[model samples]
Target chain A: QQPVQSPQAVILREGEDAVINCSSSKALYSVHWYRQKHGEAPVFLMILLKGGEQKGHEKISASFNEKKQQSSLYLTASQLSYSGTYFCGTEYNNNDMRFGAGTRLTVKP
Target chain B: EAGVVQSPRYKIIEKKQPVAFWCNPISGHNTLYWYLQNLGQGPELLIRYENEEAVDDSQLPKDRFSAERLKGVDSTLKIQPAELGDSAVYLCASSPGGRWGNEQFFGPGTRLTVL
Candidate 1:
């Protein structure tokens, strides 16, 4: 099954902070995040593995709670370039990956 | 290294017509996936291939949808007698094998418009 993301849409100004959450109904071995801009392909952002392993860029950070089957992406001091749709992908034991509906974020100056 | 490559960035077809989209994965990548995305939504997996062998296709509508990855390099997805509901973007992604849960590289995707 696909994961669930909260806050269908978010509008923020430059230097603001926001959090996007993703929850899965089943056990997840890993959580992947990607961002897609208008008229473009989805770009890989980060991946959080079970046992508290996180791999991503310094500009962005995320956390995964295995017991809760949830993950959160944190964007601090948002910039206009951050405007796009964020998708959270959940991977099960079988290596099947499913993505959430997505969270649309618009950052303005 | 070059990223995933897809052809026919935009295609417009009438209902009941046939359409095909192609994709070439990055060098030496053995895992390929096809996804469908509608407006204002995230991508939905249609099929997954592990070195030319389709490992997962539960989400694919086999009756009209078919795909092939030859020699585990390039892939082609076809829709016979397309329906208006099939109008959407078709994305192809790939990842290096030998490890599970690796990050995937996606192509620009082909925008299909069925009229």
Candidate 2:
């Protein structure tokens, strides 16, 4: 089943922070995060396994709550380049990774 | 190394017509995936392949959709007698196989518009 993302869209000023959440109905084995800009492919951000581990890449970070079957993407001091759609892909099994509807994040100056 | 490559970046077709999208994954990546993304929504997996073998395709609409990754390399996804509901971005992604959560590198998707 597709995961559900909260706050369908969010607008932020440069240097601000924002959070996007993804929740799955089924138990999650892994959570993968990606960012997609308009007219471009989605770029890999990071992956969190089922251990409730937290990962960070640059100012972008993510946390996976294995028990809750949910994950959250945290963007700190957001930049203009961060304006894009953030997608959370959850894998309940080994190979099938299902994505949420996505949270549109726009960072302005 | 080159990222995943997909082509005919955009396609416009009428209902009942046929269309196909091609993808070349990153070198040595053994797992490839095809996903359909609607406007304002995240991509939904249509199929997954390991090498030349399709390991999962439960979400693919078998009636009019088909995909193949021959020789364990480049792949193609085709839709026959397409319908307007099929309009969306078709994305191809690949990851090095064998890990539980390998990061997938995606190709610039093919935006199909079925009229």
> In terms of TM-score, which candidate is strongest?
1
Give per-candidate clash totals.
0, 0
Candidate 2 — which residues are off by over 4 angstroms?
A: A52-56
- Tell me the DockQ of each model, to 2 decimals: 0.78, 0.88
Binned by DockQ into CAPRI classes (incorrect, acceptable, medium, high), candidate 1 is medium
Best by DockQ: 2
Q: What value does the lDDT take at residue A20 in candidate 1?
A: 99
lDDT of 1 by residue, A4-109 (tens): 9988999999999999999999989999999999999999999899988777778999999999999999999999999999999999964578999999999989
lDDT of 1 by residue, B59-93 (tens): 99999999999898899999998999999999999
By TM-score, how accurate is candidate 1? 0.98
Compute each candidate's TM-score over C-alphas. Answer: 0.98, 0.95
Q: Interface Cα RMSD for all candidates?
A: 1.1, 0.8
Best prediction by lDDT: 1
